[model samples]
Target: MRSALALGPGAEFDRIRSILGRLGERAAGVGGDCALIPAGDGQLAVSVDLSVEGTHFRTEWLSLEEIGWRAAAGALSDLAAAGAEAVGILASIGVPRGAPASAVTTLMDGVGAAAASVGGVVLGGDLAAAPTWLVDVTVIGRVEVPVTRGGARPGDGVWVSGRLGAARAALDALVRGATPDPEAREAFAKPRPRLGLGRALSRLGVTAMIDLSDGLGGDAGHLAAASACAIEIDLGLVPIGPGVVEEAARRSDPPAVYAAAGGEDYELLFTLPEAASLERVRAVATATGVPVTRIGRVGEGGGVHLRLDGREQEIHGFDHFA
Candidate 1:
């Protein structure tokens, strides 16, 4: 068995650490963040994420620009999850042999545009040939008040920024014969990270944080597990977007499922001290013009549970690499 220090939230780290222990007691090769390199501390916040053609999006439904936007935003959302302000990005694009030259150019344009959307820039990237299209992005950012998933306190209040599940609906609609509305299309095509809100919340003294790129249930569970506390979320309080509820009703799928299982909703979910100021959350919403919602509170030190009609229910968020 491996110690908690080496468990990067899964069995892979545990398995590797166990093998290393058997080899001989020695220092682990990797450090904080994502690679053999330490995630770094004090100033810079580093994060990387990947979006593949088949799993993340379909070229037929989304334009090159839209695809670029989704791929870049997915990585930026990780930085947001850590409450970091992004400065620049590096993108590596994998082109299919059948991809058109115009499509490739548009994809590049979208990467540039996505970075610009967050007041960031593209530093550099690599081009490669692949059987299918793929885009990998690494974002570099700095946060004055870094918020990590492991910082939650037992009494912290749990919150989420903006609406959930719209992206899932957009894709489902596209998969079916139904046409997506402008808002749904935008949600699927170009997801905007709440970067401003993340910075503000860090200054506001949030105990811990993560982006809701995964379903809210799963993501919040991550926060709870990391903090060694129980997470209690109120389903009724989940901020559902306009048109989403009606459309979900039309589809006969529980709106809660999308809100809980949707993978592309790039919103921020965080925990704050029970006594933290509401004013800061309000200020963030005002400055960014994005809604910040209080869906639940951290429970007695334990795991995560979704509270519906005041009853606890079992659920979790999305984990692509789990």
Candidate 2:
């Protein structure tokens, strides 16, 4: 049997769909960011996020509050991608041996604060003892018309919200046993999901949408594959986060690599029809306080292409099993 590492996330999703067979077809959206289920008078968007101690973060690198907040924020970003309104969250925490009760409460406080910021609250959850600290959050959201990844069409302009790579730079700093700059640290600890912008885009008739959790390269590829179209990203147009250039230089790589392929940015990647005009997109930024930049265009094909320095380049993002 092949190991999970060999299959990777994309292939593993296909394997899961194969296992579910016909039953999987019942869900409105599967193998996307979140699953949409039919509810009375509307649909619910739900997603589960897992934060493992060694895998996702280190205790020395962040406070318990930051850990909890990061987990919830990442999970809730899925709802934003679906263009849903925040509802609530159910968090399941795994406590290891000798864990302090105060630690757990502090973590819960952060979780509650995150949910409340988005007009949500903790709906209750389960607890268990484990070998390592674990936080699993299931965020629920509601939407009248949920956006799906497979809605892009040729000629749609590809865009991204906010900036990218600040979290990646912070991760590199942590790995090096150094503290990141204040801005990068804030971005890493408390990423602001583009909830308002996402809802606005959905209302404005975006063709497709996905959050930048696993970096622009991988996420954009997923969008392309889902929409059965092609995306050409101009590397020069990608918005690199502050300090990312210096971080990339330290690692002997171009800033574009980190900006395009660094995971955990939690911004939105969406497409608008050519008819949507640049003025309209900029107006959204004015309204929501989040800048949206056009970095590419969708074409009639499959897969994502990156053009840097007038040539094509290949890059890969984070993969849990890999």
Candidate 3:
């Protein structure tokens, strides 16, 4: 058996699914964005996300409030991806020794603000002491009919909400000790979850849905693997966020490379039937105040393919262990 250190995030999740398969019907949502639990007359979607001090953020790179908001938004993004309406958030924090009590209060303030921004609240959680600061957020939401990642079928159109790569550019700029553009900085410090868009798509015949937390390349692969279908994305059609081209040029990398593989975007990636017209998608995008772009299509086969100027290119997404 391959050790966890040798497996990518996708493989690790697959292993988890295999283990959860022992539960049979009880594990219905184990492999998707949020675990679905039957509630009275509806299903409750729940998801948890962790932000470690070193792995997810650095103190010098972001304010305490930004850190808190980013963590909360990321956790809630899962609920959105599940096509659920936000209900509440549970936050757990680990404070290192000597950290001020005011710091905790300020962090919670940010968390509360983010939850409230989506008509949700910070319900309750536990606290602990740790060697480094950490935040773990659990989000609970309701969905009359939950969407799962495996529902995508052949002949579906792959679409994405919002442009890509600003957060990636900002990360690169921060790492290099250079100033990033205002748009890029905002994208990195405060990512907006497409809750309204997800809700709209859920009712608009969307077959499968996912949040682009792991970048387009990796997230697309996850959706493809789940649906047992192939996805071909046209690099030319992907909407690149402002400042990405310049940032890519600085590093001598193609803009498509970053747009395709950059992580922490938090945009929605979904599939709709081929019969759905672009005008319908545009209307949804307009109503949700987000831009929707069709970048690809679903086909028979497996894995995700990226085509740039009609030529195939290979790129990968962020892997924590890799």
lDDT (Cα, tens digit) per residue for candidate 3, span 1-322: 1111111246545566567656665545455788878999999999999999999888889888888899999999998888899999999999989999998888888788889888899899878999988999999999999876777899899999999999999998988999888899899889998888899899888999989888898888888887888888999899998779989999787897778888999999899999987788889999989999999999999888899899888878776655
Off by over 4 Å in 1: 1-41, 250-253, 319-322
Q: Give the TM-score of candidate 1.
A: 0.86
Candidate 3 weakest lDDT stretch, 10 residues: 1-10
The sequence of per-residue lDDT tens digits that candidate 1 reaches over residues 1-322 is 1222422243444464566666654543322232222345656676777889887788889988888888888888877776777788999999999778887789979988988988899999998889888899998887655676777776778888888888877877888867887787788788897788888888788888878766776667566666777777888888875447766787675676546767678888888888877886788789988888898888787666776677766554555545
What is the Å distance of residue 146 in model 2 from its true position?
0.6
lDDT-better candidate, 1 vs 3: 3
What digit string (tens of lDDT, one per residue) describes model 2 on residues 65-177? 99899999999999989899888999999888899999999888888888988889899888899898889999999999988787899999999999899999999998998
Q: Flag the better candidate by TM-score, 1 or 3.
A: 3
TM-score of each: 0.86, 0.93, 0.93
